[model samples]
Each structure stands twice: as C-alpha cells, then as structure tokens.
Target: MIRIVITGITGRMGSTLLRLARDTADLRVVGATERPGSSAVGLDAGLAARLGALEVQVVDDLGRALDAAKADVVIDFTGAEVSVGHAKACAARGVAFVCGSTGFSPEGLAELAVCAKTVPIVAAPNMSVGVNLVIRVAAELARVLGPGFDVEVLEAHHRMKKDAPSGTALRLAEVLTASLGRTQEDLTFSRHGQIGARPAQEIGVQTLRGGDVVGEHTVYFFGEGERIELTHRATSRDQFGLGALRAARWVVGRPPGLYDMADVLGFQGNS
Candidate 1:
C-alpha cells in the first residue's frame, strides 16, 4: 500500500482528498496537517474530514508528520509559501510531493524548482484532468487558428478564492501565448475606457468571483464570421482532489524532478 500524508486536511480540497484516499484502493492516509493554530491540528484527520476515524492525527509540522508516518508521499493543498516549505521538508526526507496549491510568485516557483532537484515534486495550479486537457487543446486551437483570431480568457471562482485570474486561467494564457509565439507582454490582464482597439497580438484574460461557485473557465477564439469557445466548469472540488491523489501515486519512487498534471497524464505538447 502507498502511505501518504495530506496537508491542509481541514480545507475543501484536503477533506475531499482524505475521503477519496480512504475509498481508493492501495492508498492509506497515514498523516495529515493543518495550520499550527487551527482547531483541526489536534483532531483525528478522518474525524476532521467527517470520515469517522482512520487513525491519523492532524499535526502542524509536515516534517514531523512525514517522519512519524513513514510516509511515501505528501499531498499538499496549502498556500504557496507553505507548499514550498513542505516541498523542502519532503526533499530533506526523500519523500515525494504532490502540491495542488496556487498563487505562487516567480521566486516561489524558483524555490520549488530548486527543491525538485532533490526529490520528485508534482506542483500544479489546477489538477483537474479536464483543465489540463483544456490547456493542451487551447494551445492546439491557437496554433491552428493563427493570430487573426482574437483570443480572450475568462475564469470564475468563489469569492473566497484569493487569487484574481485563477492559476488555471493564467496557465491557459501561457499556453496560448506560447503556441502563438508571443510573450507575457502580449497578454493583457485589464483594460480601461479609451484603451483603443485591441491589438492584433493581444490575448485578454478576465476574472470573475462571487457566490460559492466552485470554478469555471472559458477560452474564446474570435475569428471572421465564426467564434470558438472552449469551457470547463467544475461543480465540485473532488476532481482536483482525485487528480492530486493520482499524481501522488505516480510520483513515488520516480527520479527527482518537477512535474505537472500533463506529465502525470502523459500529454504530448503542453504542460
């Protein structure tokens, strides 16, 4: 059986992962962690996740958890800084890591890359299979449609989501820009009145947040006399949780490196 620890066990994604891991074959929840002061820190991870009891305590320190559980891998869904720290801790102990956290800055990502040189790490903004597939399909569409098509990306999430323009949205934009041979300078995050006509090379990204909507994203390709829309709507967080668990299973015993869902899913061109 694959022994695993989960970070942020009380959060939406964490709870789902805990439950899914319990039900999934060949996986065991050996440890779980939450923020140091959170009420969940001392509770049974299964109880905290409303899964009765699975004999795992929720701690605050991931390193201690990893050592105590003799964990094979750690699945983390905490903040960017927290996930980076977890990755380092896992690297120190030679435990693989699967992170589903978003909102990482350039420097934080660089830190993750550095940690990956020591142990395999799967870090992704959105771990849903459909979203990863959309990333690839969007790139292909951009390549086929060419620059004549005006591209715009729109994404929505719950109001509590901290990041504007969800990481998935930015990933889509990144692939789109790459496929079109453009750069970050060609992507527009916002616009104001009297901004003039949209530049031929500009790719627009917009954000929406309100209510309890799980997540939603749409990529539009507007061309003469026709337009194409590629959209993915997530009604629940289970997909992300399952995807992370899938990555955790695939990452163990692998060589040290940074990977994403595309690598786990075996997508050819884009990650």
Candidate 2:
C-alpha cells in the first residue's frame, strides 16, 4: 500500500479523502495534518473519519507528520495559505505531492511550483476526471468553432464556497482563451447596468451559489447557426476525492515536475 499523507485532515475534502482511502486497497493513511491549535489536531485520523483505528495520528505540523508516517505521497486539499508550505515540505522529504486546493494567488502558486523541481506535483483546481474531459472538449470546440462563437462559462457551488466564478470556471476560461489566442483581460465576470452590448472578444463567466450545490460548470459556445454547451456536474464530493486518490497513486516514481488531471487521465488536447 502507498503511504498517503493528507493535509487539512478535518476539512470537508480532507475528510472525504480519508474515507475514500479506507476503501482503496492500494492506499493507506500514514499521517494527517491540521492547523496549529485546532481542536482536531492529535485526534486519530481513522477515528476522526469514523473508520476506527488505522494507527495514523492527525497533527498540526506537516513536517513532523511526514517524518513520523514515512509518507510516500501527500494529498493536500488545504487552502492557499497552507498548501504551499505542504508542497515545500513534501519535496524536501522526497515525497510526491497532489494538490486540489483553490484560491491561490500568483505568488502562492509560484511558491508551490518551486517544489516541482524536486518532486512530482499534480495540481488541479478540480480533480474530477469528468471536469478535465470537459476542459479538453471545450478547448477543442473553441479551436474548431473559431472566434465567431462567443464563449461564456457558468458555474455554481455551495453557498460557503468563497471564490466567485469558481476556480474550475476560471480554468475553462483559460483553456478557451489560450485556444483562441486571447488575453486574460478578455474574461468578463459580469455585465451590469452601464455595460451595453456583449463585447465580441470577451468571454463571460457567471456564478450561482445556493442550496449546497456540490459543483456544476457549463461552458456555452454561442454561434450564429448552432451553439454548443459542455457541462459537468458533481453530485457528490467523493468524485473529487477519488480523482485525487488516482493522482496520488500515479504521481509516485514520476519525474519531478508539475502536472494536472489531463496528465493523470492521459487526455491529449490540441493546445
């Protein structure tokens, strides 16, 4: 079994990852991390997940957890604030890293990237295989359909999701923008009172949050004759957990570099 180190062991995705690891035969939980002074720290990870005792302890220090657990790979679902540190620590220990965190600023992303030079890193805003496929197809549609088709991305998540438009939506916009040879400024978050007609060059991203929506993204390519809509909806968070587990399993023994779900799923999109 591959020894898995999980960060943010008490969070939603972290807990889901823990529970999923229980059923995965090739995987085993070795260590878990939480923030300093969090009440959940020091709890038995398996017991915390209601999986009885797997003999893994949840602690606050990521470095200590890795050393104590002798982790082979770390699956991080923590936020931007802590994930960079986790990546750095894992790389120092020669441990593979998989990050499913969101809301990372440019500097934060750069910090996480530095570790890829030493250890394999799989970083994706959304880890679900279906979402990655949707991005590939969206890029293909954008390339084949050309700029005549205006693109818009619509996303919805739970009310507690802090980031607007969602990271997955932004990723889709990036894929479409890159395929169409457009700039980041081409993304339009909202069209309000003063904004008149939709700019032909702009791609709109709209967001909706309510009623604990797991996650939903729809890409609309509006053309004169025919329009195409590509969509993916997550009925449960276990999909993300499962995808992360696969990434954790695949990243080990690979070259030191930054990768994504496309690399994990082996989907080749014409970039």
Candidate 3:
C-alpha cells in the first residue's frame, strides 16, 4: 500500500482527495494537514471530510503530519507558497510530493526545482487527466494550424478563485507558444479601445469570473471563415482529486525530479 498525506485537507480538493483515498484499495491516508489556526485542526480527517472517522486527526503543520505518518508521498492542493513549503518538508523526509496548486511565481517554482533534486515532485496546474490531454492536443493543434490562424484562449472559473487567467489557461498558452516557436512576449492578456488590428504572432488570453462554475477553458484557432476550438469543462472537482491519487501512485519510487501530469500519464514525448 502507498502511504500518503493530504495537505489542505479541509479544502474542496483536499476533502475530495481524502474521501477518494479512503475508498481506494491500494492507497492509504497516513496523515492530513490544514493551515495554522484552521478550525478543522484536531478533528478526525475522515470526519472533517464528512467521511466518518479514519483515526487520522488533521494537524496544523505539515511537518507534524509527516512525522506522525511516515508518509511515502504527500498530495497537496494548497496555494503556491504553502505548497512550496510542504514540498521542502517532504523532500527533507525523502518523500515524494504531488501538488496541483497554481499561481506559483518564478521564485516559488525555483524552490520546487531545488526540492526536486532530493525527492520526486509532480507539480501541475490542473491535475485532471482530461485537461492534460486537452493541453497536449492544444500543442498539436497549434503546430498543425500554423501562424495563419489567430490564437486566443478564454477561461472561466468560480469568482472565489484568487488567481486570474487560471493556471490551466496559462499552461495552454505556454504549450502553444513553445510548439509554435514563439516567446511569451507574444502573449496578449488584454485588449482595450484604440487597439489596432491584432498582431500576427500575438496569442490572446482572456479571463472570466463570477460563477458557481467549477472550471472551463477553450483554445481558439481562428482562420479565414473557419475556427477550431478545443475545450474542456470540469463539472466536478473529483477528477482532479482522482488525478492526484493517480500521480501519487505513479510518483512513488521514481527518480528525483520535477514531473507533471504529462509524465504521470505517459505523454512526455508527445506533449
């Protein structure tokens, strides 16, 4: 069995992960954590997730969780800074790390890279397998469509989401830029009045908020009288939780390095 810890155990993704892990045969929830001073602390993790009690109490610190559980891996769905700290803790303990947190700054990603030198780390903005497949297809579309098509990405999420232009949208943008041999400098996040015709090489990304919507992303490649749109809509958060579990199972016993869902899904060469 793979012993795992869930960070941010009370959040949407964490709670979902806890319940799924409890139901999975080969996966075991060895520990769980929440932010300091969270009300969920001290409660049985399964109960906090409304899954009854699993005899594992949610703690305030990841270090304490790791110490108590002796986990082989940590599944995190917290914010960027918090996830980085969790990665460091897991690295120190020689544990593999899987995080689906977004909005990581350059320095934050650098820290994760450093941590990956000691322990395997799988970090992806969106952990849903369908979304990763969409990302891979977006790259292929960008390559096949060529510069003749004007590219634009539009994404929508729940208003409570803190990050604008959701990480998945940015990941799509990254792949498009890489596949097309264009730089991020070609990215255009906004368009205002007095803006002239769209630049030939520019890739536009737009954001939408204010909804109970889970998550949605669409990549548009517009050509003369024709457009191709690749879209993925997340109806529930369970796909992400399940994907994290899949990553947790795949990451254990792997070599130390930074990996993404593409790696876990075996899309490395094609993606």
Candidate 4:
C-alpha cells in the first residue's frame, strides 16, 4: 500500500481528499495535519462528521506526524506558508510530496525546488485533470491561431478564494506564452482607462467572484472573422481532490523533481 500523509486535514480540500482517499485501492491515509493553533487540531482525520470516521488525528506538528506515521508520500492541500514547512520536513525524510497549494512566493517555490532534489514533488495550482488538459489545448490554440487572434482568459471562483486569476489561469498563461514564444511579463491583466486597442502580443485576463461557484475558466481566441472559446467548469471540489490523490499514487518511489497534472495525465510536449 502507498502510505500517505495529508496536510490541511480540516480545510475544504482536506476533508474532500480524506473522503476520496478512503476509496482509493492502493493508497492509505497514514497521517493528517493542521496548522498551529487551528481549531481543527486534535480532531479526527475525518473532520468530525464531515467525513465518516478515520483512525488518524489532525495534529499541528507536521514533522512529528510524518515521522510517526512513516508515510511514503505527503499530500499537501494547505496554504503556501504551511506547505513550505511540510515540503522541508518531507524532503529531509526523503518523502515524496504532492501539493495542491497555490500563490507561493518566489522564495517558497525556490525552497520547494530544492526539496525536489531530495524527493519527488508534484506541485500544481489546480489539480483538475480537465483543467490541465484545457491548458494543453489552449497552448495549441495559441500556436495555431498566432497573433491574429486576441486571447482572453476569464475565471470565476467562490468569494472565499484568496488569489485573483486563479493558479489555473496563470498556468494557462504560462503554456500559451511558451507556445507563442512570449513571456508572462508581456501579458495584460486589466484595461480600464483609455487603453488603446489590444496589443497583438498580449493576452488579457479577467476574474469574477461570487457565491459558491466552485471554479470556472474560459479562454477566448478571437479574430476579425471568427472567435473560438474553450471552457472548463468545476461543479465540485471532489475532482481536484481525486486528481491530487491520483498524483500522490503516481509519485510514490519516483525520482526527485517538481511535476504537474499534465505529467500525471501524460500530456505530450509538457516541460
């Protein structure tokens, strides 16, 4: 069995992951954790009725939790700050890490890469398989459509989401830029004032926030004569939780490096 430790045991994704992990054939939940001072500390891994009963308890000391459990892989659905510590602990113990955390600082990502040198790490902003596939298709569209089409990405999330544009949006931009041979610094995030016509070399990003929208993303490729739009709407968080679990299973006993969902789904030409 693939022994796994889960961080953020009380959060939305954490609860969902716990429930999903129960159904996974070859994976077992060895441990679960919460940040220091969290109300969830000492709660059952199943989150007190949110999920059915699980034997594990949600603790604050990640190192102690992982060491005691001897987990082979650590799945982190925590925030960026907590995930850094989890990565460091997992790296020191040669434990593979699968992270669904987003909005990491540059220094945090640098630390994660360093950790990857010691144990495999799969980190992604969004863990939905369909979203990653959308990224792949968006890249192809960017390549074939060329500068003739104006590219715009629109994303919507729950009002509780902390990051604008979402991690999926940024990843989509990364793929599109690589396909078009441009850099993210060249893209446009907003247009309010008397901004002239849209630049052929720039991609536009827009965001919407409202009640209980799980997640939604749409990419528009527009030209003078035609326009094409591709979209992915997430109805539940279970999709992301399941995808993260799938990645955790795949990264077990693998070599050290950072990876993404594209790698999990075998998307061709991904770097």
lDDT of 3 by residue, 196-236 (tens): 98889999999999778899999999999998989999999
Candidate 2 residue-wise lDDT, 13-65, digit = tens: 98899999988889988888888998878889877767678788889989999
User: Candidates 2 and 4: which is better by lDDT?
Assistant: 2
Best by lDDT: 3
lDDT per residue (tens digit) for residues 39-83 in model 4: 878888785527777888888988989778879898887888888
Candidate 4, lDDT over the whole model? 0.87
Per-residue CA lDDT of model 1 for 1-271, tens digit only, reads 9999998988888899999999998999899999989998888999988999988898999988987878899999888989989999998999999998989999999999999999999999999998998889999999999989999999999999998889999999999999999999999999889999889999999999999999999999999999999999999999999899889989999999999999999887672
Task: Decide which is better by lDDT, 2 or 3.
Answer: 3
Clashes of each: 0, 0, 0, 0
Query: Which residue segments of model 1 deviate by more than 4 Å?
Result: none
- Model 2 regions more than 4 Å off: none
TM values, all candidates: 0.98, 0.96, 0.98, 0.96
